[model samples]
Target: MPLAGLFAGALGAAIAPFALRLRGPYLAIVSLGLVYIGIYAARNLPALTGGLNGTVVTAPVAIGPVDFAALQVGPFLLTREQGMFILCWGILALVLC
Candidate 1:
């Protein structure tokens, strides 16, 4: 996930200059074109995206000793959704800082 974020960041940085230069309708057109291209690629790439069927991406929801999937804090046990909420907010706070 971190690597994917990094790759997306890099791709965004690479495109920013050209994207930033456009204004109004031209920017909207370009953005729409890129979105279509992305959708088409995802639909066609079977090995990478599972084509039209799509793919499931699963990763261990643990950070060292803390397992977000089944988080236990003191006497309180959190449900998966609650644990994920906390984990996501924590990450967002860290990134914002």
Candidate 2:
């Protein structure tokens, strides 16, 4: 998600010059068109965005011996929601710090 945010920032920076060249309604139209363009690309590109079927994320979330997907701490087992809660808060804290 951080990488995606960075990529979006980089993309905005690169496009800023061209977008600035447009004034008033033209700029608004172009900004609105970007959404449609993204939808079109996602719908058309199966190999890229997985098209209508969508893609699955197979990555594992782990820290040392604890796999967050199947988290076990001593006799206690954590659920997926618990893992995500921990992950999200950890990321938020990291960003804040």
lDDT of each: 0.86, 0.83
Report the lDDT tens digits of candidate 2 across residue range 1-97: 7987997799789888999999999999989888888799889887977778855667777777767877766798888768877887988999999
Which number leads on TM-score?
A: 1
**Model 2 stretches with alpha carbons more than 4 Å out:** 1-17, 22-29, 47-49, 71-78
- Report how far off residue 19 is in candidate 1 (Å): 6.1
Which pairs of residues collide in candidate 2? none
The pairs that clash in candidate 1 are: none
* Model 1 worst lDDT window (10 residues): 49-58
Error of 2 at 59 (Å): 2.9
TM for every model, in the order presented, reads 0.53, 0.51
